[model samples]
Each structure stands twice: as C-alpha cells, then as structure tokens.
Target: MLKLREKLLLNTALLALVLILQLAGLMKGINTKVDSLLPSPSPSLLSVLTAFGGDVFLIAFSLLTVLLDVRNSGKLSRETLVFLVSAVIGLVIVGVLKVAINEPRPRNHGGFSFPSGHTYRGAIIAVYASNRWKRATPLAVLFALGVAMTRLLLHVHWFGDVLFSLLLAPWVYSIVKATQDSWLPLYRRVISRLGLGAFDVE
Candidate 1:
C-alpha cells in the first residue's frame, strides 16, 4: 500500500521540474514552442476543443478519474481524494489568476494563458493512474502527455499552458495530499469505529 507521505515524496522530481521552468528566462525556447501550438479556433479537432472551450475535456477527465479510482488499490483512497481536491485547487488557482490578471483567452474568450487548466487536470489523473498502476507507468505518463497535446492541438491552450500540466499539478496534488494526510487520524478512527478498513474497492 502506498502511504500518503511516500506518494508526496514521489512527486519531488516533478516539483524540481516546476522550479526550473517557473524561473524567468528559463527554458525560453520550449516555452515559445508551447505558445505557438495554440492554433486558431475553428472546426478542426484541435480548434473544436477551443471552440467548445474547456468544458468538453473537463467531462472527459472526470470519466478518467472515475475509471482509475475504480481500478486502483484501497490504500489509494486518500490519494484519490487528494487528486480530486488538487484538481479543484488548480482550477481555483487558475480562475483567480485569470480574473486578477484579466488575461483574456487568445481570442478573448476568457481564462489566463499562463497555465492551462486542461493540462493540469489531465496531469493529475495521469499521475494518479501511473502511481496506482506502477506496472503501467510509461503508458500512464504517455496518456497524460497525450492529454496535454490534445489541449494544444485544439487551440484550447498554449504550449506553456500544456507544459503546466507537468509543472504545477504535482505541487497542487502534493498540497491536497498533505492536507488529506493531516486528517488521516480521523479517517483511521472512523474506519476503526465502522470496521470498514477490511472492505476493499473490488
């Protein structure tokens, strides 16, 4: 069973990546390419995501979450809840920044252009699956990266926006994981009282 602290430790590598990219003038070339990938909105598969905005992918990601949760280990219940909380925290962080910066979408739709919400949520679920299904690590990472690519292909977000998927989501997930861990005592107590710890996800 993966402990919450161990799960948080697993993300240290990703956090290092974020630290590097977040610095000004760091990875300029990669950043520019990321921004360039946000295509003009239209009927193209890529543009369609943008045309419809982010709602479509959000729903799709939710489905991914449910599927992964069902397939994951019982010990991951805390981590699973953490991932959900992180997704919301990421959304809220983006929303606050977007409104404060008043950074309109490329075509002025709405949303800050710094970090893409689609990428963040996609990354969280991807990490969730990868960690829980260790045998499928590469595939899980690829799936997450693919989601980031889709965001760029559809012009729903810029390259940097997609890049944030790997960059920021780890930190957000850690925050949620830590918060959840803080309440583990209560959870164990509740489980002990209900004797549900013996139950499994199926």
Candidate 2:
C-alpha cells in the first residue's frame, strides 16, 4: 500500500508539472492534438460505456459496495467508509476547481471544464477498488483509462484535465487512509453517539 507521505510528494510533483505545462502553453496544443485523433462521437456504444463513469452510475456503485459490505460483514468496513468519504470530498474538490478555474470544454460544450468529473470519479473508484483487491489493479486501471479516453473522444475535457484527475487519485486515497487511520477511534465514538453503532468498523 502507498504511504501518506509518498502521496503528498507525488501530488506536489503533479501540481508542479501541470503548472509548468500550462505556463509553457503546451496544454492546449496537447488537448487539440489528441482531440483531432478521435472519431466523431457514436451515441450507442461509447455512450453506454461512458455511463459507467456518470454521476448516477458511480454513486450507485459506491452505495452498492457499502450495502454489500453490510450484507456480508454485518457492519460497515473502515475501508468502505473511507472510500465513500474520499469520493464525496473528491467531487467537491472537482466542483470547486471547475468553478474557480472556469476553463472551457474542447468542443464548446458550454460549461466550466478544466477537469473531467467522470474521469475524476472513475479514478477514485478504480484506485479504491484496486487498493481493496490487489489482484484487480490492472482491470481497475484499465477501467479508469477507458473513462478518461471517452471524455477526450467526446470532446468534453482537455487532456490536462483528465491527466490531473488521474494523477490526483492515489493521493486522495492515501490522504483519506491516513486520516481515517489516525482518527478511527474518534470516528467510532461519534458513530456510537449518533446511534449508528453498526457503522463503527475497525
């Protein structure tokens, strides 16, 4: 498993690299170049596949995992809680950045689109699932990559946007892990106080 300190360092490096690329004026060129290579959108297959990363699908998927955990274990797992919290926090971060940066989409889709929300959520779910099931790392990664590709193909996001989402994923997981590890006792206490004792997963 990746440690918190390593994740912090990696996130810093990624942010620096994004800044450097943006400053060098290569970000737009890169997005344009990649966009040119993709074929016009086909609403059937690509639409179906891309929905795997959609808000409804991802949210339902997250809840389903939690429900499954409860069904099998009789209590919520800390890992599951962390995954849900991380995903929610990640969404908020993406939303804030999208509004703050106010970047536009590639095909004039008419909304702030610095970062791809689908790709971000996909990365979070992929990394979280991979962490839980080590053997599934390749599939998780491929799923995330496919989501990123679909965004680009649909002309909904810039390359840099999805790149940042992918780069930020592990770091988000790591931070959530570290925080939960340290504050778990408090978390348990709070859950107990709230009459949700079944959620107190060690």
Badly placed stretches (over 4 Å) of model 2 are 1-4, 23-26
lDDT of each: 0.61, 0.82
Cα RMSD to the true fold for all candidates: 6.0, 2.3
TM-score of 2: 0.89
- Candidate 2 local lDDT, residue 154: 80
lDDT of 1 by residue, 1-202 (tens): 8777776666666655644564453645665566575554554665543322255665676666556655665433555556656777778876665465443344444556656666666677766667667888888677667767766665545565566556677767767665765766675677578877532222
In lDDT terms, how accurate is model 1?
A: 0.61
What overall lDDT, based on C-alpha atoms, would model 2 receive against the true structure? 0.82
Clashes of 1: 3
lDDT of 2 at 168: 69
Q: Which candidate leads the pack in TM-score? A: 2
Q: Report lDDT (Cα) of residue 32, candidate 2.
A: 86
